[model samples]
Target: MSDPATNPPPAEGEERTSDASSTDETVAVVQAQEDEPNFTPITKDFGFLPIPKHLRHDPKHPAYFGLLLNATFGFAGTFVLANLYYCQPLLIQFSHTFNVSYDTVSRIPTLVQVGYAVGLLLISTLGDLVRRRPLIIMLVFICASLSIGLSFTTNFAVFQALCFLIGVFTVVPQILLPLAADLAPPERRATALSIVLSGLLLGILLARVLAGVIAQFVSWRVVYYLAFSVQYVVCVWLYLVLPDYPAKNKGATYFGLLWGMAKFAVTEPQLVQAVLISIPSAACYTNFWVTLTFLLGGPPYNYSTLVIGLFGLVGMVGVGLAPPLGRLIDSLVPWFASVIACVAYILTHVIMVGADGINVAAVVIVCIGIDVFRQMVQVSLTTAVFSLDPAARSRMNAIILISLFIGQIMGTAVGSEVYTQHGWRPAAALNLAWSGLMLFVVLARGPHVSRYTWVGWEGGLEVRKSKVTAQKRRDEEAGASDIQQRGDEKHALEAKQSVREEKDLQDATTVGMQEVKISETSEGEKQGEDQPPMVEVATLSAE
Candidate 1:
């Protein structure tokens, strides 16, 4: 005999029993599977190529973000953003090549900026809705194709259209910034963002130098051809190395996401503050760069295109300072950084106003100061906003960048016009005015002491306390409800047990009465059987 727990084979007439037992076991297994919830991962493996085990990204896995991935993001962001500024130094060349006036050719950069803003609004938002690796690859490929069109086009209209398209698709940097923030550790997120931003700054500065040098010796068209090659290379690099990021907003519709962005702009005070500060900062930055071309190329300077482009090298100091500023933002409150940047912006513009393009030293100082301070402000604001909501980084980034590019468009259009019509002093003064407005807004709304009656610090504190109190009340209410429910459940269980006991007692009493009646009937039957034969015999004799 086998052990009963082993479920030994059925005996010769127990086939039905064996089959029924097996059927029950199968149903139990299936039911158990059905009870478990389905789970899907937020990050996916890179299927396009055989990515190394150490480079893969998964929240559960140990393949953490490291230096190599950071460098890859930096390089990819650099070249993709370089497409935007290549045409800046080539504006004069475009004028001659397309046989258009300088004023007409100047609109090309503005159109590019407008297209960039449109892309930030429409395309970059999709980063949250789709896998970022594929989206980024597609954008880079299209941008490379656009570069080819730009390289060969002679018609100004076609050239302008291609430039716009180039700007539209060159939003990979915007997408990468948020991706970097997502991948980096919490303590180092700001530093990671700054690394990518540093590359972008380098691209903006170096594209001018690269375009000017290539166009000076060779043709301006070569610049675009080179851009085309560099883009393709970056595309391949991204395909091989970039880890996959699954969609964050999986079930959301496109229009709904846009609407959500509008809501964020209005509802999130930190985001609103960042946007307001970034707009004027961006405007001033673009204003100075756009007008500097005119100021350097005319009057006392008469700088050639190459000479003008070389000035971008002076701004590299800002790129070098970005990482440290990011670390600073991580360690301290971002408000201090913003205040410092605003002060620097105001002072830089004041000096530019006084120098009036006659002092080369002053221009270089302005370049370094603006670039460094702009990085400070940008890194600080980005750290603040990204910290507000981790899930909405792409959309939040889109909002801030859309505003920034709008400011760029304004600066490019208005700065060129102002500098061309008036002199350097007026253009510098306009930048000064923007800086002043930025500082005023930062101080008024930022975390600072002000005599203004509308500061609302006390009100803000009260609102925070009220929110805390309300949350505590809700928790207490929930706890009370749970306790009441448990008590009700306990009372219901006791009532059910009492009813069952009463039912059992009634059944036991009825069984006892029936047993008693049966016993009595049996006794009567026995007595009658003992006396019945004699009575029947007497009746027969009498008859």
Candidate 2:
């Protein structure tokens, strides 16, 4: 049999009736191909369980990213980000296990934070260059493998190395944040981001609780083993439920993306302000948490790992403030929210200074206050940074997060040293100073910088209105310039087209006149053949 596509021409009496049917089939094939998703699947089937239709990947009718997906992002963010903080509460156990000094073991958490910053710089930026689902899955699997290595390692060097690697590969949360921002509806984006952020905060707080309780009952190694299991479980969950998000910058090189982050840090004023604000806030936050373990574990409190970890539960009250604060940031100007949070942060540190290690109630209050204010600052700054550029969210996130972890590293290394050598008051004082600096930055660079004389107190509602009015005027000016440029180009093209049409009409008139002259000559020749012709006249017109 011959192929229909290469069929011979029809005979003289035959009709060509197959063409329309074949054309329809060809169109259907093209439509089917167009409707297919342009991504590679990690697996052909959803693993181990039945996936709801809404949860499954469908290119034709994308499911709305609803509560279940939000919950998945939250839980996954919690577990993945928890890996960084797990060893904070277990610093004592690590010191005892490694047969090292407190200062020596303290480097573990610091190194982990440094490694995480490095990962934010290097790996997290790939979210813009590659499909996020596979990248996320790969990172989680690597992190799980590192966790198992951490569990089995007896050598301090090996443990530190494994911890660093775990931190480096545990950037899944950073990748997920941009994905959530991409999928979430604009009206509900803040709520969605808050949900995931809440999970991250919970992970940071709850990881300690979980690690402390487990390490208190069993070996510290068991904590790693448990983390390993949980990471893999979350990894599988992500694999099954996560939607495939195509890369935002498909052809971008990794190095180009890295360079773009540096450029963004320099160019985007909001991003720069947010990073500056977040660095110190993160340092102060890390200082309290890292040093709190030492303060509670020593003299007056003398708490065990389990008791110390339970304080993370107290921090949960702060985590509860995330969604509300997210909504607040959504309603208010983000920098204004940051200003309020900075004030709360400074007051919290003042309370910390008064606690003096003897007042457990004051310490608990400080914990809750720090957690709440820290959440506020983070959500506000992030909202501001994310608002700057949709296409560059991953890179912008990396810039801010790298700064954040750098601050964490500073806190871990410096806060621990300060607590060890100078005592709790000095460490608290240092954090107070950082908080003061944060407030200063916010005031100078926040809402009404031009009109405000000192710490934003000098400016009132009038200052705010003036600022808004000036901003509006500037925006209108920019829009007007853009419109003017487009209009100029359009006018130029229209003028050129007008000239070409006039030239064509002139040429057509000339051709029509020549034709009429020729016809008149021919008519005169015919008249001469019949009789003596006096004069032949012709009237010509061009349309």
Please report the candidate that would top lDDT against the real structure: 1
Top candidate on TM-score is 1
Per-residue accuracy of model 2 over 237-296 as CA lDDT, tens digit each: 887788764456657788998889889887766677778888899899889987988899
Please write out the lDDT profile of model 1 over residues 1-543, one tens digit for every residue: 111222333443333222211222112222343354763333333445454443343333322346677778888888889988898878888998889899999899878877887899999999877778778988999999999999998788999999898888889999999888776655566677888899999898778788878888999999989999999999988877787655676578989989999999888777877888888888889889878888888888899866887888988898888777777765555666677778988999999999957888899999999998888888878976786665688999999998897788778778878888887899899999998988876666644223233333432322222243355467878999999999999999999999999999999999999999999999999998888688789999999
TM-score of 2: 0.72
Model 1 poorest ten-residue lDDT run: 18-27
lDDT for residue 178 in candidate 1, whole number 0-100: 84
Error of 1 at 7 (Å): 57
lDDT of each: 0.77, 0.77
- Which runs in model 2 stand beyond 4 Å of their true positions? 1-63, 89-107, 153-157, 294-306, 355-358, 413-423, 446-543
